[model samples]
Target chain A: MNPAYGPNPWQQTSWDARAACNFVFGGVGAGLIVFAVLFGAGGLALKGLVLAGLALVGLGLFCVWTEIGRPLRALHVFINPRSSWMTREALSATLLFPAGLAAAAAVPGFAWVAAGLALAFVYCQGRMLQAAKGIPAWREPLVVPLIVVTAVAEGGGVFFVAAPLGGGGTPPLDALLGAMLLLRVLLWFAYRRRLAGTVAPPARVALDAAGRLLQLAGTLAPLVLIALVASGAASGAAAAALMAIAGLAAALGGAYVKYALVTRAGFNQGFMLARLPVRGSR
Target chain B: MTRWAMVADLRRCVGCQTCTAACRHANATPPGVQWRRVLDMEFGEYPDVHRAFVPVGCQHCDDPPCMDVCPTTATKKRSDGIVTIDYDLCIGCAYCAVACPYQARYKTQKALFAYGEPIASEAKRHDDARLAVATKCTFCVDRVDAGIEKGLQPGVDPEATPACVNSCLANALTFGDRDDPHSNVFRLLAENQHFRMHEELGTGPGFYYVWDKAAG
Candidate 1:
């Protein structure tokens, strides 16, 4: 009963900005590998994008590594696959790195293998938050789809931004970006509505700002840009530049929302008193 | 086949915090951490108000979320139903901290002292292994184990009972085996109307709050 942290649901201090960075980086990274394979990039462009995806995931894992209290015992994170989503994530990473390298090397049939592992990695990341029953904002069943869909949208955004830089020129990623972004926006609103009663008041306030940004820049503006590109308002470098801008908008939207979700909205389930005890003859 | 549990009679509690002091004195929990603390709550509006003191801590649930989310398997539930932590095996991920609905888990990276500096009492209990790992109430597991080894019953023996229960000035708190039909906890539950916190969450909490039997 610390007077400061008391009886109501309080924001959890267990995770900070670093934990948010993991999802931001890892989500885009995992999404990139899948999109690259699905879109069919070859030669140096394939290698470049795949390597970039693997690097981002590695960076995300490194961020978590720095936050551990006992870094020496980190290998123990792989010990509990029977129950822990985190252990499944680590195991997926072990497979993802090797498969990503082979795909980047243009090995036949490896791209699909790498993409599958990457998708599983992203899935594990989503489950990580859902597993925390104490945080009402996270334990919502909708969080899984929301996170997974956002990553795919962000990945499609990164694919458009990076694929054309090496002249590997994307094949109509604008439609894919629009599709994922729309889905994400819908899921975001649905998730917010679902958490209306469960989350603390402060958490709801934090989610509101992120929700606005996601709806505007992540979904609406990107759809407008895709239309302009299709109507041939600009072509060549100008068109490529517009697509990259749209992609960055989508990617950053998901990341900022995730950051807000982890840092600002992570509230612990406070004490709940169902009824007061009756006094004698009162 | 014993499931250790505790019950708090809300009518009898006075919000004195004597149990809190005893728990800290027994466990030497670092500053800002209370393994056992009573919640002082007020209900109703002006001209008609009532205050209630509800003791809160680790519920030690039958299905612990902390245990399921732990990647290291460092948190485990014993046969006696007390959840324990393996400090050395824990990587200090704080995953369990977020998983606990009762907010019972505590994790700190640095060794803390009660005074500005380490005093004689603080220096004697400087534990390095506990740092950077989750720690919480074990329902005084060590005392219960030792007492049991000496052929002493936990509910009946003052030495085996939790420090908080032993120090309760109002005699509001009781601890005993839940499965034992002849135990104090079983008798109390049979005689009184009680409720567990957040029962809707399906935590199956070991702690119970006794209100009244007449109302039921």
Candidate 2:
């Protein structure tokens, strides 16, 4: 049971690691679709990235299925698309998976369409978090942008690693990764600043610390690696090593952010007594 | 359109918690799961200390965040303003519990008795469907509905009224229709100064607290 003084008497967060994985994988998966479409890296590189992304999105939904009290009735999640964002997310995934397969098969027309659906899926994921009005941190208007930006950053990171592995390398991707990292860090700061006043003190502190950590490891480290590659300070195997490390750090950071937000800082709005109870005479 | 509401007169409440006990008995809720509770609030400095007993439960708002966020559409609001959870449909995601700012919702994953033993009373009243699902005060919807079908007014008839309202020894709790001009809740609201919890959030809560007589 939650303490009386804490934000909301219900201390248990509704969304746990399972739910966070749904967002992380879904976001990254969508980002990969965009990467595949933009780079036009067919053969193993495109197929592998798209397949991995689809697997991740599938895994995320599976994680949510495991979290529900009634696993048997999980299909009911699709029934309320008229209002529920969860349904919309599910609907988007249905389109994303088939489109991703087509893109992987080198269907030119399907690539852009898949990329579009992936973007919508990522946006829907952000909206899902924002719609949870009970949790002050989640409902912040900036959460939507933060989520979308983080997903893109993570997708960029994945492409950086996957491209080199598939013998397809591009100089522009390093710059793009740097830009995404900068945007993600900026969004983190803005989102944290927005939450400083409204969120519970403990939750605010936790988020602040987490956001800072994300900046250092997720954003700055990747940028440094990208800089090393550009400066010719690290070439051939060394540059590949740096890119891999940077990509891993960036992707992990995005996943960690989602985990912390869903489980740690996800405090409820707590109980509000309309009027202070009068003393003595009353 | 009868909108059901509860009015708690702060001046009259003695904070005996009889309402809590009655609610517990009526619902047969598992241990630690309280549908209704009385909060003992103390205010002012030591010398000027004053105590107030506040009975808190589900407000059953017109714009319920719980219903809106429910992925399974398990939570629903009645035409008469009662909010209910379809236990069978609920996945116990606790989304509704987190969405309710009033702390009105509760989720119990297991069945437990008051003591270590599963008593006869627990077995008789225990609902298997309620396990791992969000539960809260329905304003005694079963009683209200049954009474209405029998041509009895909910707020006026003791049998039709909520257990908490009927059990309040101080007569502090009042239940009636907010939309009805002749209803006790409407009359009380018209005659007294009242406040609704988190009214600024625009939830349009059904519960009202009559704080002062002079302010009305």
Which candidate number maximizes lDDT? 1
Going through the candidates in order, their DockQ values are 0.66, 0.50
After superposition, which runs of candidate 1 have C-alpha atoms over 4 Å from their true positions? A1-6, A168-171, B214-216
Number of the top-ranking candidate, with DockQ as the measure: 1
Q: A18-90, model 2: which lDDT tens digit per residue?
A: 8878888888878877876776677778888888888878988888777777777777777677777777888
lDDT of 2: 0.82
Assess the local accuracy of residue A264 in candidate 1 as a C-alpha lDDT between 0 and 100.
89
lDDT of 2 by residue, B1-216 (tens): 899999999888888999999999888888887788887876567898666788888998999988887888998999889999998888877767767777788877677888877889887888889887789999999999999899999999988999999999988999999999999999998887788876767788999988776451
Residue lDDT tens for model 1, A87-109: 99999999999999999999999
Candidate RMSDs in Å, in order, are: 2.7, 3.1
Give the chain A TM-score for each candidate: 0.95, 0.93
Pairs that collide, model 2: A8-A270, A279-B50, A280-B50
What TM-score does chain B alone reach in each candidate, compared with the true chain B?
A: 0.97, 0.97
Interface RMSD of each: 2.7, 2.9
Residue B19 shift from truth in candidate 1, angstroms: 1.4
The residue ranges of model 2 lying beyond 4 angstroms of the native Cα positions read A1-10, A279-282, B43-50, B214-216
